[model samples]
Target: MKERVLDLVFLIGVLFKGLDGLLELVGGAVLLFVTPGQVQRAAERVTARELAEDPHDLVANLVVHGAAHLHGRSVWFVAAYLLLHGLVKLAIVVALLVGTRRIYPWAMAALGAFLAFQLYELIVRPSVAVAVLTVLDAVIIWLTWREWRRGRELRTTWRQTVAWVFRRPQPREA
Candidate 1:
């Protein structure tokens, strides 16, 4: 009976992980759609900065030279920022999924940790959307690391089978 209960708990945990993965997939898709343009502009601005530039000075310059001119362009600016943010997040999720074959158990534990963090954020300290997304990204990273350690063997076998099926025959070496 205890073993059966434990099995149920394990199954529930797996289901929860699946749900978390799905959420990440959705979030990633949304981010991809929302985060490219703004990122480009931000990247451009950062690239323009010389070494050892003070952050406050940079902000002041941006507000004066960039934001000041953008009173009429605020909506576009915001849209670009959102899109770029989402795209970066999407990229992270993709990377996590890619590594899953090598790290399943670790992935499961990390997903649990992520859920715990989200509970804390929602119940104890509500943050802005950006901060929440950042937390979610951290959780995904943790999950990926966990999966890497636990899923390596399963991944190896799967990979070997795939190679066997698709591998081209080579001529005998002289």
Candidate 2:
């Protein structure tokens, strides 16, 4: 039951990351085809509705203000960032799900780096979503390490069992 729970945790992490990557990929592709003017107009409409619904929402206000300030180059940058980020995450998810022992350490390193960056950003910006994601990343890192150790132990035990099974019996005493 404990092993099953561990496997479930690992699988959940992989699925979450895979889904996030898919969203990023789809969003980036869609953004690439949208004109800056369209984005600005859509942002304005959404902002107006959000402000009308609740004028005191700081996040909505900030998003509206930022949207107003975006340029064509900013849109392009966003698209490129989403695409690259999605690709890398998807690759990591695949490697992890495939149980690539060599990639586990690197995956943990990558996640740690991202988590550190997110922590810094959370400190600077203080978003609830970023904070939640940072926590999730930390958990995933722990799960990955646990899974790796479990795999190593399983492999070692399997090797020992195989050796024991295949070993020839000692010859009769002289």
Candidate 3:
């Protein structure tokens, strides 16, 4: 029962990862076509009301500030990064969903690499959101490792049982 619950949690985590990947995929594609000026305009349009209401809204101000300083090169870099990251994540999630044993270790390794990169980013420039994401990614990787081992053991035991059941009978000497 505990294992079942853990499995459920793992599934939920994977689902969230897939959803996040989907969002990144869409955002990256959209960013490729949108100009920095357009992004700033949209940010101003969206945050105008909120900023006016609060006059000191942190989130709204941050969005406006970030959008204001966007450069064409920076935008392109970010878009490309997001596209690659999202595509890799989506592929891993699909393999995991389809129960591809061969990809489990590879997926975990890829995620671990991403986590290591995130850790380096944190060291260079810390952000609470990034920290949280890094932690979550670590947890997911650990869960995947555990589940893969469990599945491997189960498969080995199952194969042994099947072989024993199907073994040819020994010849009896009269």
On TM-score, the leading prediction is 3
Ranking by lDDT: 3, 2, 1
lDDT of 1 at 104: 51
lDDT of 2 by residue, 1-174 (tens): 565555556666767888998898887897899887776787778788778999988777777766676678988887887787777788888776554578888888888888888899898978777888899989989987886776653234334545655679999998
Reference-based lDDT, each prediction = 0.47, 0.76, 0.81
Candidate 1 lDDT tens digits, 85-162: 434434434444465453454444544554565667667756455365546555545534443544443334345545
Per-residue C-alpha lDDT of model 3 across residues 1-174, encoded as one tens digit per residue: 566556656767877888888888998898899999999999999999999899799789878987898897989987897898898889888877665578779989989988998999899988766799999999899878887887653244334545555679999999
TM per candidate: 0.29, 0.68, 0.78
- In candidate 2, position 113 carries an lDDT of 84
Record all residue pairs in model 2 with backbone atoms less than 3 Å apart, i.e. clashing: none
Residue ranges of candidate 1 with Cα displaced over 4 Å: 1-71, 95-128, 151-174
Relative to the true structure, candidate 2 has a C-alpha RMSD (angstroms) of: 10.3
Error of 2 at 114 (Å): 1.7
